[model samples]
Target chain A: MHLYDSTIPSGNAYKVQLLLSHLHIPYAITSLNILATPPETRSSDFLAINPNGRIPVFILDDGTPLIESNAIMFYLAEGTPYLPDDKLAKAQVLQWLFFEQYSHEPYVAVWKFRTYWALNGFEDLSGREIQKLKERGQAAIDVMERHLEGREWFVGTNYSIADIALFAYTSAAEQIGFSVGPNVKAWLSRVEGTKGWVKIKKDETGKCPL
Target chain B: MHLYDSTIPSGNAYKVQLLLSHLHIPYAITSLNILATPPETRSSDFLAINPNGRIPVFILDDGTPLIESNAIMFYLAEGTPYLPDDKLAKAQVLQWLFFEQYSHEPYVAVWKFRTYWALNGFEDLSGREIQKLKERGQAAIDVMERHLEGREWFVGTNYSIADIALFAYTSAAEQIGFSVGPNVKAWLSRVEGTKGWVKIKKDETGKCPL
Candidate 1:
């Protein structure tokens, strides 16, 4: 399997890369620039593979193209220790995944996009953007922080993909100018301390698909 | 299980209501005006139940509170026909769920919010808000149109939760002032004609969560 990824770091793409490493699965990576005007993903060739023009798009062993990052994570980790055994626990996992998408990702991810990669009045990160990032983003973090106050992971007692999905962008949120209070910061360290955990970064070749 | 849902006619919430009726599971519906200023979800009481302050939160028989409409749908439908049994098929199901969250929901759902809810020019929409919605939302619909050129369902030639999730908002999209191309219109009809479907507006005397 090969992943067509973006070079510029994206938390969503990083989730897939980290999962592959954690599982010791071998794969090739290709880099694309999502920040480029008329993103490289908009190109006809890339669009042929994914009409959505997003990443990290995982081409499975049989060459099936999986576009959404969380979907790819679920595909790779299903039936493994990374996914839960109890049906309700699995539903809990999906709960967090949905939370990340609807709440955390919308606020924090876009804040990261504007503050890091696409900073400009054209994208307009002033006033309401900053306000929303602070309000909704912090609200999302508060939910996670409160949940992590006593538990080691989001769903059950183990390290599941729910943790991986939420951790991908959150660890580096400071770079995007978002704050993680004490509770979330402590949770981050706990997650990092887990075995088989890997930091999402460029490979030895200094390239990855975004 | 009792559901704190409203009759404001949300497609996301409708997915749960439809499945509950099909399964003959009794649930209570609680309606709130999500458009009201400082939306009712932000109330201290509602936040105590769901800090994320969103609607269609479900309370299980054991009093477990499940937020995120899709997560609630999964919780209700797990181990049932609503979820596929095949491994790859199930992953495909989740693939659409993730897609609905990241791509479809943000775009189509937002379009509904801005159009139907009279939220477009409100202080909430802001200038940048409309821009991102127009660009990204249109792109999302374009991708769906391309994907639906020939396929009836999103995956595996059957009516799945993916259809329910997407159909929820996509069906009511016209009321929200968004136009569905001929392809999506036909797709909507196909989904509406499926077995075990229900309209967004249930009987006025629908049970309430008390």
Candidate 2:
């Protein structure tokens, strides 16, 4: 299997990488500087693979192109311990996946992007944009903190993709000025303790050099 | 099953309603005026049901609270024809679900809300906000149109939840001033022809009275 991943340590792609490592699934990564000059993800070749033109696209052994980070994580982790077998538990995983994409990622991921990689960074953003980012991103982090209260994981008793999906961004919450509570902070450490865990590394450009 | 649905004709909740009708699953609707005088969705009582305080929250017969429209649709449609049996096909279903939430809904749904439901509608938004909404929404529609080209349904040769998830908002595209392409128009018609098809309707206050 091959992953059309990003040069930047995308939390979205990091979710997939964290699972593949935990599952010990061997796959090569094609690192594209998604935010670099000409934006490789927007290239015709990449668009042919995924018309949506996004990174963290997983190409199956049969060469089928699978897009969407949470969906790709679902595909890679299906039938594994990372994806539970019980029906509702799987829905719980899906629930967190949707939350990660809709509520969490939009705020947290964008904040991280503008804060670290973009030309303006967070400093370049409007006072309104900065306020919206902090409020929304911190709200997402607060939701995680509340969900993590009296629990070690996001979903059922085990560490599932829900943990991975949430952990991907929440791990970097502090950098985005999100003051995560002890609960969310503890959950992040627990994700790090998972088997076959691999930390998100950066390239010379300070991107997730997966 | 009791569906803690929205009275505001939310496209998100409409996805679940469409699926339940297709599956012939008996469900009672508890319609809350999410956009009512006080906005029932933000009340402490409603927050107790879903901490995120969003509508389209489905409460199962066992009183388990299932949040997130796609996740609830996945749960209600499990083992049914709306959900396919193949593994890769299932991932495709998930792919479109994520796409609908992340790509399609944000632009389209928010436009729909601001257009008709919000106090100012599109006219009230700043030039930047309106521009962002239109551009983002149109870009999402363009992606869907490209995907729908030469394809009847989003997933493997069937009208799955992917169709339902996409259809929920795309059905309202025209009202929001989006010009539908021939291919997307045909695809929307095909979705309408699915089994147990039910149209999304609005009551006196332009809300989904259920």
Q: How would you encode candidate 1's per-residue C-alpha lDDT over B53-160 as one tens digit per residue?
A: 888888888988888877787777767877777777777777778778887778777665555445444456666667777677667667777878888887778777
Worst 10 residues of 2 chain A by lDDT: A201-210
- Cα error, residue A115 of model 1, in Å, equals 2.4
Clash-forming residue pairs, model 1: A5-A209, A5-A210, A6-A209, A6-A210, B5-B30, B6-B31
The candidate scoring highest on lDDT is 2
Query: Per-residue lDDT for B1-210 in model 2, tens only?
Result: 888877667788889988888888888898888667678988999888888878888888889999999999898778988899788899999998998899889998998887777875676456877788888888888888888888998887888999999998898897678877888899989988877899886754743222
Displacement of the residue B45 alpha carbon in candidate 2, Å: 1.6
Pairs that collide, model 2: A8-A208, A9-A208, B7-B208
DockQ top scorer: 2
Off by over 4 Å in 2: A123-125, A207-210, B36-38, B206-210
Model 1 chain B lowest lDDT segment of ten = B201-210
TM-score for chain A, candidates 1 onward in order? 0.90, 0.94
